[model samples]
Target chain A: MRPVFLIVLALISQASLADSPPLERQQALLELLHQDCGSCHGMTLQGGLGPALLPSALEGKSALMLTATILQGRPGTAMPPWSSLLTQQEAEWLVTQLKQPAPPQDANRH
Target chain B: MRNQNLNNFRYFLVCLMATVFLVSLPRAPLADVRGTGDLGLVVERTSGSLTAINSTTRRAVGKITGLGDLSHASLVYSPDERYAFVFGRDGALTKVDVLENKIVKRVEQAHNSVGGAISQDGRLIATSNYDPGGVRVFSADTLEKVADIKAEYGDGQLAKVVGLVDAPGQKFVFSLFEAGEIWTADLHDPKNPKIQKFKAGKEPYDALISPEGRYYIAGLFGEDGLALLDLWNSDAGIRKIVPEYAKNDPKLPVFKMPHLEGRALVGDYWFLPAVGHHEMLVIDRREWKVVRRIPLDGQPVFVIPRPDERQIWVNFALPDNDKLQVIDTRDLSVVQRLTPGKAVLHMEFTPKGQEVWVSARDDDQVLVYDTETFREMARIPAEKPSGIFFTARAHRLGL
Candidate 1:
């Protein structure tokens, strides 16, 4: 019974790990966030044509809702759907990153 | 002994003459002394540097670094074509001397700025800002604040300004993005500007002045039309052109907003990029009617004409960003297609328009091509370059 319980626990952990994007893909997503998204929402995510995505600006916003917006996109606006490029889990991860404080290193730094 | 002394005296006289001639001639401070007319600047966006290149030499002459946030940078040259005022995304306006290849003066004028323009006389420089939304004008020489025209509208709220361009009669014209209006600040009296406002279409994203500086057209992002203001006829108000050109078709996602500056006005037809569509709209400038819609591969970013106006070159947004298509003005058809490099950003032709320089950001190079033969002439190494502005832009009415 103990061996069976340990196998089930290992299976659950593996399933959760599969939900998150790999480290390499995360780096690419970050680049897209800074460069492509930065085209409209300033390079530092301070805002341009799009609104600011800083932690202060995104305060109290639902991460799930933001993830949905990222995947489905807002209609009648310049923000287009990224569902073709990003998965639900990946979109959620991007939202989590956006909600947190920006990293110390400059996005434009080579 | 007497002959030897005479020969030595003659040699001494020749040496004295040579020294006098060398001292009398004007001393050059630098080894390479050249005019700024043939020189241009390429904005190294990611690195925050400007690569000053000589179009005549087809090589980078110098790199001016330390201008902050050049991700969406643009520059305008002084009337003398010696100094270039670079506007950074972080709202820093840097005055760089192309001849000396250094920053002469830099001022952090706003929190976020888009682009700038120099006055007709080139005495004042005006920057369009997104944050604190207004147009700030400064003295071209000292970068001192000359006038600050706030884009206040609808219950005293500030709106972001875009498409700032210099018009005739010491005027600076720009479009209000949020307020959906166009304003002309007549700085004939720099301290006290006579502001004139015109109600334009919804979401005027960017604007461009005609080559003759008579028409100021703002491209609307929210609608399928453009706001046309005849600077020559100010009392007529704004007119909408090509309304509902895309009414039948669904709008596609625009990864990048199409830039309207330096648009192609070949002969009587005005070639413009249709937003959210892989097409170029040919409009008759005389009647302001859509003449033809040339289908393209992707959403067009810049539809610029070669100096000779024989051909129109176009670059696209993401997915098709690597491709560049050339259209023949005679038949208005896609004449040639070439994959220059990855993420092709901007292009600038030589003063006379013999060769064109294209910046490919991902490739980290600026490729030069011969206009007539359509062959690669040279490749310049750059660090994520974007805008390429030649000093010749100084002479053009609206660049």
Candidate 2:
């Protein structure tokens, strides 16, 4: 009975770990963005104090290109570099979230 | 065999019905028409965004975004009014539904297609891109590329293509800046438009042909004059330069700018913004000479004649005492000073000519002033607002 229980536990742990890497990174980056940058970037990142980062705004740019912009902000514009504020890996994760499609808004539908 | 004969007969009847339906019904219009009331247009250069405002209440009803690095976005309404094509900085073009104020599609290929000319029928749009040194053509419907014309600037080319004006039929006229050349293309067959070139001025910024499309006039920057070129005689290979206002007057101080601001064609005369002489250099096309110098102060960026032909609305960018100068075309005198604003770059008029849309760069807001009362009605905030065009009648024209 103990051996059988151990086998079942290992199977469940492996399945959970398979989904952990990207999901955990995405959640952490989103939390940091919400706590640190949401003051200007808006909660959903629709862009208020800062420019919009939704798919509509960053249409032609690729994820890697946008990540570079996050690390090294555009010059002569209000955007500032986040290289000092965040690690390169973290910045890449944040850009990936920004590139993702904006979730459909339920209350704002009207 | 008998059953097959009946099937063939039915098919022929259906084809006949379709042909009759197509032939009897009037031809469908080209583009969708958008607005009827006052439709406000603004280009936010820094953010690469555009907004369509309702002029009456001063509310932003429609929004267009993702236009790349839009420095000078020019809006053109389709004859049917359904769509408004915006030409942005670095040649980014986007089509918007003015009524919905939503971006329909964007053409990212024309990187330098800044400003362009749309055919009167709304069939073709000709854009002169910089880096590739050519004009790009796009279909009004799908925003798909239709043609490309090679018109690169030469070694001595001092001016860029300031603006493009469509002529009768499918001809497109491109006004070259320091190059002093008006490049014309026949776009009836856009895939291979016949190109023609004519020399005009030292640094011709904007050129306008007569309503009948006979004469072409370009404002020569810093030269204190306007150039008159006869397009009617293009087939004769006759190119004449009318530099009547070329000489600077000693009394007025020269306000040297890198480029000419704007030009207007009224009847047979061409009214060009004279930067050096502080006046509207009006040149008679027939005589090809400066008939009158309408005294103006600071630097004029735009001079739009009222539809009534009684007055002209002149907008300037310099923070000199006068920013909005209303010139009485009959006497060519400064009739009224509209507003005292810093760097009034461009002006657009309401459909009925009741209000003037003034883009104040220093203030980053669009000021709406009543033409009759000359009072500031409302100020719509924008970011580095550069160009404003009306889309009120765009939908009907299908532009």
Candidate 3:
């Protein structure tokens, strides 16, 4: 029983290590950001009441440069600092995802 | 040279740390491009502006604003079809010229105004508010607050008082709201009016009085049935819940909750939806019981009865597959299902009964449908337009 327990624990740790977001999961996250965040911001990430979060929105800012803006946040503006809610790693991942161009329109677009 | 080398090494360390930080930080901010253009126009309840739809077709028509602090506004067109009275959401009242599309006058906030009502004679424009537990009477012509009659009720009770129907003779105004109670106030003297309260339901929202003014039926949102009220009986228990129809139907989306805000008196029967039961509660006025529960497609919100009382117009409010479910009350069967909008809220029939005006809140526009054919007639752009009433009789009543 002790030997089996040790094996199960090892397997669990390995599984968790491989739990990085897949393409579909990343797309879903992007969709939520677009839907929920786009309400206040322009759909294309053009400036509205909120500062744009897209590549065109940020004018091709580097990942590190964007991280500084998100971590410190714009004071006296609606853009709240995300450092509290997001980890450094998660912010880095988000910045990497935003760097990609939006997909072309499809026939089944909702 | 050794000290200079040491300084260069320190600078190299700093650069490495910065590079690590850049590589580790998230490269993207969330891209929320989805929810921006869902609803065309949003009526800012806190702000007093009627937002126009961002479309060329809508912009070509026009935009009107400057009605003050209008909260949860219910609208009604004048009898002569010249003007519209907006029962502003915040209890302020405003009148608008329908053709010119401009606000004529603005009235200040009254009690907790939820529903807007015009008297039969159109001489009195009365609206009910929930918080202060009173109704404000306004002169339709002058847009003046003529009177405020606070009804007597138990202390520490918060009654919403949503539904108001002025009796045919215009002698009394009957209304029901949050606490499931019915009220009758004498309107002969608008100022210092006499008010009476009756235990109507466990929770009531919208009500319809019989044309003859002998009986009143209210949709109880809390109790999930219709509450019958006897107008003439002073000591008689006027409140009776329809037993057979009160239970929620498991089949429909509006199943078994209790009540929603739609009721209409058609022919000798009152057709309404149970809040939880996706079925329409058909009350046989003659029998005073829920004789039948007509099952429907989704959570029914508004019921538009034809002037001829032959057809019943019902709209489901679900965001997905939201459509206008038309029930021919004559047979209690769904004759047609038309997708009016994404989500429908309230509707009113033109006095001529030729056209039906439905407020598609999800789409931020009012859809007009021909009564006879149920075909799309025209669309009126509105801001979160929900409540509707008519003005033809209103002009005659001087309201």
Best by TM-score: 1
Candidate 3, lDDT over the whole model: 0.57
TM-score, per-candidate, Cα-based:
0.90, 0.65, 0.60
Please say which candidate is ahead in lDDT: 1 or 3.
1
Clashes of each: 0, 32, 48
Query: CA lDDT of each candidate?
Result: 0.87, 0.63, 0.57
Error of 3 at B119 (Å): 3.1
Task: Give the CA lDDT, 0 to 100, for residue A14 in model 1.
Answer: 47
Q: What global local distance difference test value does model 1 have?
A: 0.87
Name the docking class for model 1. Answer: acceptable
lDDT of 2: 0.63
How far residue A57's Cα lies from its native spot in candidate 2, in Å, is: 29
Model 2 / residue A10 / CA error / Å: 55
Q: How large is the interface RMSD of each prediction?
A: 2.1, 16.2, 16.7
**Model no. 1, DockQ:** 0.35
- Candidate of highest lDDT: 1
Residue B238 local lDDT, model 2: 29
Candidate 1 C-alpha lDDT tens digits along A26-84: 77777778767888887777788789888899899998889988887787777887887
